[model samples]
Target: MRTAAPYASDPSRVRGRLFAEDESAFRSPFQRDRDRIIHASAFRRLKHKTQVFVEHEGDSFRTRLTHTIEVAQVARTIAGVLGLNGELTEAVALAHDLGHTPFGHTGEDALEALMQPYGGFDHNAQALKIVTSLERHYAEWDGLNLTWECLEGIAKHNGPVTGALPFALAEYSARHDLELHTHASAEAQVAALSDDIAYNNHDLHDGLRAGLFSDDDICVLPIVGAAYEQVDRLYPGLEAKRRRHEALRRVFGVMVEDVIDTSRGLLEGLGSVEEVRGLGAPCVQFSPALWGDLKVIRKFLFTQMYRAPSVVEMRKQVTAVVEGLFPLYMERPDLLPTEWAKDVDAATTDIARARLVADYIAGMTDRFALAQAEVLL
Candidate 1:
């Protein structure tokens, strides 16, 4: 790894973990944080979780695990170019989607609606819950007991939390004071934007593969259209699959390069990591032109892919599964697994029991959730 920039997060200057331990002799703190995240149960569950498609929907679609890896790749590249802590960026990227529910955003949306009276669902906040209080593998602690910086990055990855927070986030922030009002470190910001680049580009690929749209459909869009045009100029006789791959790779590259160039221009006078955080805006971002173009592409995707009839049908099915399971589990906490049953039994209030029910449902894999719905509903 190259030396980090002055504005980069320094593991040596860490705010320390919630439960302190002796520093590792070989690995940096951020590297250890990355390793812990990789070994986490929630991280492993991502393999069976959804990005845009459910896990059982197709073999080729990107799961939360694959999407996180893609985001990490983009984040590390941008972080390396900008002289930020690549390991920290990679760690944040890897852990960013850990709290996602079973059926992608659809499951989350359904759960959020059901929990509206109980403070609602937010995956970012759920991620904080997973890292801080849910993962119980550690002998010394319930959660991963990650470094303060890692927690901060994860909490503020989407920028500041100025308004009222979700229940999970508010509870955790009350305990650890993640400084939710300030922007995260540049590394976290890199991880956040890398998520955008990965999902936007990969969704295009997945949508094309799923027959949600076509080359003709995307070729009329902004950034994607330009990428296809470039690929045609370079490889005129390319086959459809290769042509799609080639064009999309160029789209990914353009987005990555835009962030690097734009961020470099933005970081000209920033001298310290604190300065970067205090700016109250991201230091890692695409240029205004590309950002505008990406918004157009995103709008196109929302209309043609996300809201398509086939996808909406699947979403409705999965949403039914989620909504059914939450109330069933809440009504019969004995249906919960042994470990979760203990938590449910200890709950003294309706809201507490509801949260436990949410946690159980939130942690389920897609197949598991569907199976549970069938048996219990």
Candidate 2:
């Protein structure tokens, strides 16, 4: 049977203010953003960046690039199953971490502290700034002219809509019911959850490979062990090279099936087309019972993997690199990309200066940021 759903319109095809081109045989707006981001210097740098551990440690472990790919795959799987826009979900998944700092969250934290007074250094907001006004690709403008839908996805990737919107957007609340304090589209929600599912499960696997933790340690964490047991039952000897890939794949397949089952039931309850599209139900999350299981899994990973003394030690080095770089760059903006000079001068105060510094740093990819830090040091 055909899906009783509207055809997913590409956000790129959505009319925008500044992207009106006369002679271009262009793609949709979201597609344009995806392609532009793929071509950008920053997106390419994800290859050298850390997802959990730094990239240079091992070839098998996930880098930012690989992690993004996994998230996109997981997200696309969920979106396609749920009749959401798979391409839009993939686009958001690809661009979701575009503004993550060099060493992942550690670098983001350092930059956030350094730029807190300057409207804060959030990865989501920086991503918005990058697509809207920061990154310099074309001589015509400072950044990529992404569509509002893509911008909205980036801004609200993992946060509450109330907190995610810019101060100005706070006023235009009603026109965007989706923009207001409401649930994100099923696509964005799927991407967000996929990010959590991908990182939490994979990070544990990586931690074990690094010898920072062991499977026994992970299995000790309440229901997480059970989940692993399920994996074992589904694909035993997952530690074996051949089974490891299959094991992970089964986990994703299982989780995605859960999401689809839940979402379809929820969608059935919506009475009309307007309600279905305009007011996204909050039923997109993992069901509470399943989430309870996931929580136990997350807690075990957090204590045994993320906060392990060994990981902290490595993160300290990353923190130092970002912290060291922020001050030096702020003190001498000339070190940044040439585009920042005008923004710096237009700044009326130190707050403005700090914001400009953030613009410079946030635009950097993992490798470029590290290289620049080394040059400054």
Candidate 3:
């Protein structure tokens, strides 16, 4: 591996895990964290979790797991170019979406609405809960017991946290503060930007594949238009599939290169990871020009894809699933799986039970929730 930047998160001086354990003989803490996340049941469930489209909508549509892999790929590339710790960046990227509910953001919105009175639901916070408490496969610990830096990245890779914290995050922070008010490491920052890059690029590809928009429609857009023009000039008669792939691949490259160049300048002289965080702003960013273009792209997607009629209809359907399931479990805690009975019985308050129910629902996959809704609701 390349020498990490001075501002990079150094696993050598990691803040350590919540529970005490011996260090690994073979892997860095960040690598260990990444492996744990990959091996996690939550991570596997991402395969059936929704991205923009429901998981069952199409075989080729990007699911949460595939989207996460793309984000990690972009993150590793950016972190490597910037001399950040690639493993930590990739780890953060891989774990970033672990908290998303089934059926994409729609499911989250539904559950969030139901959970509003119970301190509300946030995928980021739910991800923290998953890593910190939900996955109970360990012999000595309930969750993965990841290192502090890994948990910090998972908690707030987007930037600092302020205002009201999500209930799970607030609860965890009470025991072990995640320093919700400050920025995360430069590597974590890279992971955040990588998510933007992956989704922006892939959503366009997925949208086109789903026939929500056309190549001509996007050919008039900024960066993508230029890419198509470039492709046309070089491979004038390229097949549609190849052309789309080639153009999007270039679009992806542009975003990646922009981040590396922009952040390299921003982080050039930073002497430590603390400096990166205390810098009080994100160092990893797209150029203003690209960011503006992405907004246009995102706007186009919001109208032409995300809010497309078919997607909207599916969203409504999934929303009902989450909505129905939350109350059912709350009103009939006996409906939960046998394993959850112990926790359900232990939940002494309405708020506690509500949050517990949210945890159970949030961990569901698209099909499982649908199946459960069919049988129970």
- Highest-lDDT candidate: 3
Clashing residue pairs in candidate 3 are none
Error of 1 at 91 (Å): 0.8
State which candidate, 2 or 3, has the greater TM-score: 3
Q: Name model 2 segments beyond 4 Å from true.
A: 1-4, 7-18, 22-26, 163-180, 220-239, 269-281, 341-346
- lDDT by residue (tens digit), candidate 2, 211-322: 8776566566644555567767876655665444454455556567777787777776554333543664454667677777678777777777778887799789878887
TM-scores of all candidate predictions against the true structure: 0.98, 0.85, 0.99
As for candidate 1, its clashing pairs are none
* Model 2, residue pairs in steric clash: 12-28, 12-29, 12-30, 13-28, 13-29
Q: Give RMSD to native, each candidate.
A: 0.9, 3.7, 0.9
Candidate with the larger lDDT of 1 and 3: 3
lDDT of 1 by residue, 1-377 (tens): 57778999888999998898998999999999999999999998898888888888899999999999999999999999999999899999999998889999999999999999888989998998998899998788889888888898898878999889889999987778888898898999999999999999999999999999999999988888888999999999999999999999999999999999999988878989899989977888889999999999999999999999999999999998988888888888788989899889899998899988888788888888988888888
- Give the runs in model 3 whose Cα sits over 4 Å from its true position: none
Error of 2 at 95 (Å): 1.0
